[model samples]
Target chain A: MTEVVAREIIYCDICSFPPEYCEFGGTFKRCKDWLQANHLQLFEKLYSDDALAKATSTLSIEKEQQISRDLEKKQAKEEAKMERELQKKLASKIIIKRIERNRRKHVISISGLEVCNIDMKKLAKTFASKFATGASVTKNAEKKEEILVQGDVSDEAKEYIENLLQEKGLDEVKVEQIDDKKKKPKPTAP
Target chain B: MFKKFTKEDIHSRSNIKSSVQRGLKSKFLEQFPKLEPAIDNVIPKKSQVILIKCEDKISLYYVENEVVLFQHFDDLVPSLRTVHKYPDCFPKVQVDRGAIKFVMSGANVMCPGLTSAGAKLPEESLPKDSVVTIYAEGKENALAIGKLTMSTDDIKSINKGIGIELLHYLGDGLWKLVE
Candidate 1:
């Protein structure tokens, strides 16, 4: 059986050598030096900065300025869009409320703090120690994990969270006060 | 169980000598005779093997772009983990849904968990102390790798006690090495 071998041909203008064998001759540097010594005119024409500038002179100054302005506008628009998205994300309000469990018993429920870049367990511990009450990280009825602090500490917790956010440089965090007591309306007299 | 490795350490460790690599390949093959064909596929020729010794007597084997295998003091041979990239490169034992959490949390594989209703085992029984990969039921990849405490035949005969001693599992230090 006869074997057929297929070979690929690659040519470099400066080196005038096959691409595979070009490395053996120490890249195009050797070829450039040879060209500089033997073919001065051609070397000067090919390697000169003036030739490069002339080759790229097709675009007028006005066209170049317009292209740059367009690119800058596009980049500015992208940056603005990214900033808006970041604001939207950070604007997710951390909702704090006081939930009445029974007569004279209340618990402060803090939600949406999970979205913030803070440890939930450590935050719970801090709340527990700061308020001298039992605080725990538990999932609400909606299966959303939130921090629950014993007693009506919404106002205190809200201030603390805001300060914590500010200290962490998360000034964009918005705290929303939600009163769970007002959620259920009293039945009208019939 | 792990020490921080610098960029220089990684470079020096990865450039293992050819003779040493060959010895490692042979040792690995001898330990798992079933992986003879797939050995070259997993650790290909000219592939660099990096052995990083950690604080807890565990050796991390970084093969090319992936963390392929790990060895512990109690382990007679190196075992493959999920981070190895190539699934089914080694022998596998699928555990039940209830056992997935424990396995991922680095708990020893109990016989009851493996013999549960939904669990699956290989038709060909593996010998005791053999390196085996543990896969979760309904999952496509291996979750942990361990050494079988008892032979597959004995495991089928009995229903209690630890069946596999976990060496490496998901979220273990070795799993986080590549990251």
Candidate 2:
């Protein structure tokens, strides 16, 4: 007697494989169409192109281009405003002030030389040797980097800075002095 | 055995010029002729090399994202750990589970640990003093890198004594420095 062995073939609704090897299946186009027809609710829950497009219409290419152009115009306007503000700051003036550190002790601080493009380290070193005082480059409360020299050397510093700027070919560099209100003399008895 | 390294010690080493670095690369390739094709890919022309002086002097060659290669001692041997970064770049030898602790502790690899049951070694012949990565039994990552003390035939025949001299192992100074 001869025995017959039955073989069963299974086709994947997802791909060419028997569903166990779905990852190996390259494309899901046929499976997508089958699901769209056979399982409408499941397909709609899984993927809805029309609904996604409706939800993110503003992010579409045409809308995005329009928004990007508007953003570019706004950025250009802001950049021009910033440039004007910087020019105004450069034109204003340089202020050299003397602040009282303690009784009979004061420190000289120079600010607004940021537009000059001079090296701060070199400038500080020059001021230290020229004025015979310890000088350092530091940032002020306003977040502006400036030079601070020990002892009150505002008058000497102002003249030196003006001469240095002129030597560097910056003709319009202006130096201004600010009086220390905290160090003012007390009123005498009447 | 490994030596401790400070940040300053690593930084003080001079940066090798591109021309000199090329010479070093050629020397390394001469030692391991099998790595000719993959050498360029590991240490590209744009990569930088720094000569670090240590007990076994090391040359650290690296780029921003990847540590390309490091040369040790007068031999200028290429780093097995770095080459192992690229899968199958070098032949691997699997040690028995009993040897995993010893390997991690930076001990010389024993021949029995490699020829024992459940251990594996490449079928191809590997020359003496060749660099090969050591992996623990059933593990995917290489646990240590060593220089083969003797040829593959010697290991197969004798199946005893030290097979490879452990150069860099897990938790060693070189591993920490690379990290």
> Clashing residue pairs, candidate 2?
none
lDDT of 2 by residue, A23-97 (tens): 122323455576677667756754567743443342346754554455456446655776697677558678898
Q: Per-prediction DockQ scores?
A: 0.01, 0.01
Classify candidate 2 by CAPRI docking class. incorrect
- For candidate 2, what's the TM-score of chain A, rounded to 2 decimals? 0.49
Model 1 docking tier (incorrect/acceptable/medium/high): incorrect
Cα deviation at B172, candidate 2, in Å, is: 1.1
TM-score of each: 0.44, 0.46
lDDT of 1 at B1: 24
